[model samples]
Target: MTSILLDTPNVPALKVENLVVDFKTKNGVVNAVRGVSFSVDRGEVLAVVGESGSGKTITSLTTMALLPSTARTAGVVEVDGHDVLNASEADMDSKRGNVVSMVFQEPMTALNPSMKVGKQVAEAILNHRGLSKAEAMARAVELLDRVGIPDPAVKARNFPHQLSGGQRQRVVIAIALACDPTLIIADEPTTALDVTVQAEILELLRNLVKETNTALLLITHNMGVVADLSDRVVVMNAGKVIETGTTVQVLTEPAEPYTQALLAAVPTLPEAQWDAIFAEERTGEPRHAEPAGNSPLVDPVLDMREVCVDYTSGGRKLRAVNQAGLVINRGEIVGLVGESGSGKSTLGRAPLGLVPVTGGEITLFGGNVLKASTREIRKLRSRIGIIFQDPGGSLDPRMTVGDSIAEPLVMHGVNGKRPGRAERDARVRELLEAVRLPAANANRYPHELSGGQRQRIGLARALALAPELLIADEPTSALDVSVQDEVLTLLLDLQKEHGFGCLFISHDLAVVHSVSQRVTVMQHGNVIESGLSSKVLQRPEAPYTRHLLASVPSPNPIVQRQRREARTALLLSSGTRGS
Candidate 1:
């Protein structure tokens, strides 16, 4: 093993002493981060977790000296013995991507889309190490290979859009690890990936940390991640550190209520497991929508009949979604659960006329969505809102949060056919406040807001026109669990009050279980199962469905504790017998 040592003989790789970051806005100085302090040792992964507006990202950015010029920062941030909080521009510039590098939550935006990924990575090497173009490009290819990209040479030449989300993230990591930095900060690294990919990324990071002896500052809200990867954890709330402890201590014996709540929020079962259960559950005790009652059953806002989505890649025809059929009754929250590439997204998008159906028909509220005219579709779109998985990407960086929320309402001519500017501003503020965000946040850009806040804003935007059918495509997938719970609860309450149909798509069974009344399982574009959430999850019949259910990591602490104890007992008993 290569013995990689930290910079200081005894001091930790990173130490923060009373870090404070404040943003001066139109209203008042928003204390984005207040009096935070922590230390990360070499080979240690320290997770800083909190909801949106909790200052997790701000704290790290301030520590890295990557904060904007207007932001006022006061604190002592020392990384590898260098005092970074007060470091001069020249000093910071030299150490920025060399001694310390950061991999942002969205690698697509972080990386230059116009340039080749290899060339961009090579630029970092050339700027920091004075390497020639040929040498840097060669190093870039090697770095790509090191990050586990198959056919590194070709991959290195490809642009960001040409790669998968997982591959793009890996490339970003490769860039961060290029100079062998002592400290690497990853902010919500696995936000948008599927479970299997998430597991692989986490494992890869763990292995990289071990191989390089790198100190990692992981900023996220996912408790599952903290449990799986973090050696130590710092829980943040409203710019302050509420609690800090080892992963086990924080996860199992949290001292703070916020910490405890955060842990309770992550989805339990993997998507594959849930998909299998969904298919099998259909085979046994299938649930049909209750017949029309005293109150006439509302017509389905969106209905699918034998819908099939297909794609041809590498000269192979791939049936992404097979003859899938489902109905979204008016005001019903229909949960669609499946693994990656299982056709949940395909079905969701089919209603919006975004994805074409190959073999079946899709109708919207007695009208054929596939046959809807451009003008008709545009009119229909006003009443059907979609909130995507990544809120940041869905939002425009150039537009203010208030403007983004108002755009839909303005386009739809809400409140007396395009109300006055003052009225629209008031509506924006009200929407922001309704989402539990401070009204002052309306003036800020998407980049100024936290991930959770951005998602809330995205929801607010979706709700702007008060659409009858709200299609949320993995809306909470990118958010931290605590924030995710809040969003989920918000969605549930919104549905209850507004009485709008919600076609909620997700890969997480536990999350789907929380909000959705009925569940639909799709695999390779075919509807394998459809039933009451309880029936589908509790006693699934299909082998695939059972496997999916089994994939749910056991959340019962007692079970885990007992298993560990039993293993210990067995080992001791065997040792005694041998002796």
Candidate 2:
């Protein structure tokens, strides 16, 4: 047996060699990571970019020596000369909270709901150091302040739910940095936040890494973040690292086709692209689009006028949605964009009669849906389709994929209208084909497929009734960047062929710009801005619209390089000014 110390000459901050990890299951062994190797130097920012199930998370977990007991791993993970893989539980514990720490993706799930934030952070510090409780709490407040919280003293006493998403993420970062760990692994830290908040967090992390002289391993699917924050980038796919290089090298000239394809998939907000898209819209032909027939368009799909939804909480009437009005014309695609609580979803549901409208007219295909009977609404419900954000939760575990897709057809009395069992199976195959999924995959369960595949299945089910209008709520937000491209493209093609109107709602402006014909910006339950997609996107008039547009991430190497240079110069200048 050999003992490894923390300090060694010529050693990098962290090093991984020939790492392999496997999980045991009922069917067989799932090999997540296979012979992966990477290293991070002191004060260096390294990014691991990959799609879901690419073994990126597993690799990071293995390096941290956080694998479960049922899992088997063989690797050489040397952090500051310590062999983490071969270390005992007690030996690992000593370094786990002191030498290396991680910030998880979902802050809500990571934090303890019942405890105050300051106490939680103080516990981490108390475990690592021999400091008194008061001293630990003082350090916690300092950490919160360092992470950009406005009022650390008051915020520290609040619970997790009391804070916003960005604030919670900052708290998580504060906790991870409490002990001044030499190495930090941030796994999808910005995925849950809006673009503006994400930018701020990335800048904060980059600045902290530089100031503390710490090494950072950032796992993300956002190429923009990679470009702006990472010194070096590594591309992973299917348990392997395909490419690794400096950010400039990878963004400017990539040797691998996959790398190039990934970069291309990220939607860039180039002025020329927006102008051209709008120019086509001006001519009434739309941009980069095929002519879709109105045959599939239904009459009076869903309509709403002067709709308002109000909620009473804590003796205060909060108008989540004001006299907001909307109408989903048959086969016409309308996009909705707004901040976190702008009543977009509320207005979306008003037409379907899902949410109670305080004051407004609601109709479906010219039918009076506002006062329609339950049976009438039920009969027309199948004619309108909706795909929610969480596709997995929306699906049923007890039902197989085939049953789930076929359920709508069977319920609508259309299944028996088909020729026979053989013909019905053919229809199921056709629907799956429409979504670009393998027909044979219908027999498998949803759990077996990736998130993207599940979402496609959700789309398949939504389209089962051949609905005239489709309501998609943040459909692509949960997917990886590469998968999101395929899904968005598929959605556009389907809408073209089916001539079905779509109401696309999302927080992602880039996605909205790419797929939507008309853009509407909402704030505080009011339609602050609305017009042709090209005009609004290219020339935003409202301040909030400008803020939202500026938040979108761009893939252009030159743009990111310039931004990085500007920030670096500002920091240098600020230092001189302070002196």
Candidate 3:
């Protein structure tokens, strides 16, 4: 490994000393960051990693002088030898885009909705570089192309909404690169992206830093990312830095318990053993068992034969699902694994009649879904459940938790009759208890709950109907690793208790390997590979499947470096540089 410390540096690109930030809340004074210190030299990547609410983001924000008015901060934050904490408002504003810049976590919210992406990037340049609109726009297009955006000229005119999530994030990066700042702070830049897109973006960032000799301060919770990109690392917990070392040292031999725990919580491949451990932890009778005589006559709960789903956008026909076929037998979990735009979501929703299939057949319990009547389809839906990726977006803000859970019951008339208020309320309470939430939490709104709690609420809502099949679309993608473990465990337990076959769709291979007994890999709307989860994930047969597994970064720095080298060799042999 290359030595991270600068030996012949004239001056560091960024530095912090005894940084402390506090916020006065209704409860008390909240210490967001306490006595944190680190530095990033020119061309160096320094990663600060921690769980949610661990003060990693706060430290980066404080370094940028972008903290809220309520925040009280002290100590030093220097960017290119300039004191950020002590800079005047006007000076800080002048220094923001020129000396230091930031790429936020969520590009959709960070970018202006009304502005064109090209104009947005140009505006950042116009603010600091004083270029004409035409010149700035041209430069913006160049930056977009530099960041690997295809057909940059055509894409430049598009609004943020028109771009995919990965493209939007690329636009955000282009904006950050507009001014060519000396230091770049990327906060969870690839959190919600697919593994392939994330790999591309990470490669882009690494190349840009090397070519421009710019320092990068990356703040994220993903240990894999730290292993993949960071030269040095600082581990933080509850507003304090607990460990600091070169990337190899810190990741392989962490000195702090929090850091160790964080690493341990990360999901990895060869998950058959982990699944067995989880099964043993389960109480009572086995949820999955063959009927008497180990019979093979039981039909699958969900079956799709040559399923095709199509859409029309901008006068162009988009084939989202193309002749895909799969089956989920009773009480079995089948993982649908793919990158974004791979038709995983479309396939998951096709059986529920949410997305119409243009051709082919989908059968739920021998009932034709594509050719079923409206009333028949309505009846069919009562036996199906779906858990969306974002619980906050899926749950109605105007409704209370209890009412949201009971809405499906009220509509379906759970017991063949319109349920009374008392009956619905009782069911809601029992659902809450089943998900391990307090009965009192039934009165709370979605916003009142934590991220994990809200996800559990979403689960309760999905399981409220006692359906035979559950379609979980990236349910734990937004949660922390520890929280994700809890949610996964809870999902397994509930699936056992309810005996529901699950179609678990996710872009995370490790997560898919953890809970899925069978796995189906999709690519560009096609089911490329299907088999036992262990064989497909651990020893993938397809080149694309192997590439996906190779792209996932391990928490161990040594292993991650080896994986990176192997990926590089694969790319070279395939006649493609890093995309």
1-579 per-residue lDDT for model 1 (tens digits): 111335446877889989889888899888888899999989999999888778999988886788887799887898888888778999888787788899888899999999988998888888788678999999999998888888999998899999988899999999998888889999999876765456557767988999999999999876666666778889899999999988777778889987777677765642233333344344555334332321133578887888877778899888878878888888778889888888899888887777756778877878887787988887888888889999999999999999999998788887449877898898888888778899999899999988888999999999888889999998987676777878888888888888899899988777888887778887666777777676676655444444345433333343333323433333343353112
**Model 3: lDDT to the true structure:** 0.86
Better of 2 and 3 by lDDT: 3
- RMSD to the true structure for each prediction, in A, is 7.9, 6.2, 7.0
Kindly provide the TM-score of model 1 when superposed on the true structure, using C-alpha atoms.
0.73
The Cα RMSD in angstroms, rounded to one decimal, for candidate 1 relative to the true structure is 7.9
Candidate 1's displacement at residue 338, Å, is: 4.3
Better of 1 and 3 by lDDT: 3
For model 3, how does the per-residue alpha-carbon lDDT over 1-579 read when each residue is reduced to its tens digit?
A: 111332337768888999999999999999999999999998999999988988999998887788999999999888887888888999888878777899988999999999999999999989888689899999999999998888999999999999998899999999888887888999999998888778778888999999999899999988889898999999988899999999999988888888888888888775222233223334323233222312122568888989999999999989999999888888989999999889999999898888868999888988888888988888888888889999999999999999999999988887578789999899999999999999999899999998999999999999888999999999999999988988999999999998998999999998998899888999999998887786777655566876787788777777777777756755665667644
Clashes (N, CA, C under 3 Å) per candidate? 10, 2, 0
List residue ranges in candidate 2 displaced over 4 A.
1-9, 24-29, 271-303, 414-426, 561-579
lDDT, candidate 2, residue 451?
A: 91
Question: Order of all candidates by lDDT, from best down to worst?
Answer: 3, 2, 1
Q: Write the per-residue lDDT of candidate 2 for residues 1-579, one digit (tens) a residue.
A: 122433443678789888888899998999888888889987899999988889999888876788898789887898777888889989888877678899999999999999999998898899899899999999999999999887899999999999989999999999999888878999999988877678678878988999988889999988888877889988888888899999889888989999999888897754423344334434645323211321122454666666788888899888878776555566566789986788898877777777767787777767888678988887777787788898899889887887888887777646336345575577779989999998998899989989999999999888988888899988998998888999999998888899887889987887888888767778889877776677677666554665566556566556766544433443343353112
Stretches of model 3 off by over 4 angstroms after superposition? 1-10, 26-28, 113-119, 130-142, 150-164, 271-298, 313-316
TM-score for each of the candidates: 0.73, 0.88, 0.89
Q: Which residue pairs clash within candidate 2?
A: 300-365, 331-501
